[model samples]
Target: MENRELILSIKDLQISFKTDSGTVSAVRGVNFELHKGETVAIVGESGSGKSVTTKAVMGLLASNAKIEQGSIYYTWNDFHTGEKKEVDLVKLSEEELQKEIRGQKIAMVFQDPMTSLDPTMTIGKQIMEPMIYHYKKSKKEAYEKAVELLQLVGITDAERRMKNYPHQLSGGMRQRIVIAIALSCDPYVLICDEPTTALDVTIQAKILKLIQDIQKKKDLSVIYITHDLGVVAKVADHINVMYAGKIVETGTTEEIFYDPRHPYTWGLLSSMPDLTTNSDELYTIPGTPPNLVKEIKGDAFARRNQYALNIDYRIDPPMFDVKGSDTHKVASWLMHEKAPKVEMPETLKQRIEAMKRGEEV
Candidate 1:
């Protein structure tokens, strides 16, 4: 990990929204890093601040939203000068971000293709728009690049498709077009926020593969914000398990899947569909997420955590280093030597063993 280049680094990011009821704390001191050519996934249920964190990176937060603290530092290589440039995204003005960072350095592929693209514009024009604005390319140059982008994203008959509007294409084709537009500017970092939420199951797998293929080809750093662990299992190199607007566990894919430590992570893993399980009923995490509007004194997930200790109710656990691994970390008192020994669910242990044995689950 130390040998790889860090593409994006976010530290202690806190975001809130002004409302009639009260100030809604959407994100609470979140931190994560994206390395060059790596895929990191933020996994949690709805309202867990997964999308909010990514939106902050894109500087696309709503008018009512407030950035209370933290910085998003992005580092990119200057191809012309062969030098590395670093910028704090939080400190940049909206105009500066639009002109310099957004699209040129970082681009986002949103959840819904139908809503993300302009209904009135042709798909060709939409793809060419960013290239012209950000790269200052001529119309002919942008149009040629747009066609190549469509082909790069696996769209057949690219030239013909360019003339078609978003409504004319199928859901999968529309998503492919959206990806083409994102890649038009040759961004160093790609943020995908529930990118496959609106697609069919088969199409979802294809889109995931396309993104993986493109990431390797472009050597782009990718951040996937989603609630589905199934998706994370397939594409993520690292995983961040979030609960109540905070990351409770972070580790490599192998560490997170085979040796999860946090109770919240255990719940998430157990709740995943296991076809090998004998029981017909599926597992589900008990209790709902805590309200962000209310004050949380102790651990945010303590109420929902089955293995939560007494200390969990009184004090939030700090991120503890997992034994024998530098990359694995969990925010749970169970990691402490003085804490009582607690085992994960028997079913989850069995599932992990089965997976290790090359069984499908």
Candidate 2:
């Protein structure tokens, strides 16, 4: 594999929200690194902190949300100076983030296009706004670039579509417009929060392919926040399996799909529907996620993990390096040397075998 430069790093990120009842810990010591031109997927159930972590990176957290701890280090080459620069995004003020980082260095494509788009604003103006605001480009220059971006994202009749309002386009076209806007600033990093969730299956596939092609063309580093492993299987170079408020497993795409270590990861993979599955009942993880209002002791996933050990209830497990792989790591007692061997469920094993045979699971 070619060595890639690190573009962003999140270290020990802890975030909480001041709810009416009490403080809810939304993210706990989350850490991940993204390299130039790499796509990293953060996958888990709703409320697992995937979106919160990325929101923190973008300085988009709500007023009640607090970053209790951690650092988000972002590196970029200065355009004028031609020198490397690095900053801790967590420490940047809202003003600094707005003026220097958000939408300029890093852009986000939200899940719902309707919510992201201004129904009253023309699509061309929406796409050109960032360029005009950030770069102080003339209207004519920004207009031409906006049209080009629309074409780049595969929107047909770019000039005409630019004149249409948000309500005038279909769901898929709206999403394409959203992608065009995210790329309008020529950001080095793209954060996609379930970008395809609202679209149909065929549209979902097309959008995923479009993002992949755009990433290659622009050499963009992407962070995808989603619950869909199916989408991760297609676009992710690496995977982080989040449970509760922290990542339970981290590995390269092949390692995660073929030899997932954490029980949470096994459950997630087993729940996915394979083409060969004939059972009427769909598989689901047995229990609901733990409440964030209460303090979590030991492993946050211990209560729901079918393969959990006694130690899982008493103490939190450190990230144990998986044997024979440098990139694979899991937070689970099962990885300890003295712990009894517990393999992933047999059904999941069969599914993995099918996947290895070029079948989708």
Largest lDDT belongs to which candidate?
2
User: Candidate 2's error at 57, in angstroms?
Assistant: 0.3
Off by over 4 Å in 1: 1-3
Model 1 scores a C-alpha lDDT of 0.92
Off by over 4 Å in 2: none
- The total of clashing pairs for model 1 equals 0
What are the clashing pairs of model 2? none
TM-score of 1: 0.98
Encode model 2's per-residue lDDT on 53-152: one tens digit a residue: 9999999999999999999999999999999999999989999999999999999999999999999999999999999999999999999999999999
Per-residue accuracy of model 1 over 142-221 as CA lDDT, tens digit each: 99999999999999999999999998999999999989999999998999999999999999999999999999898889
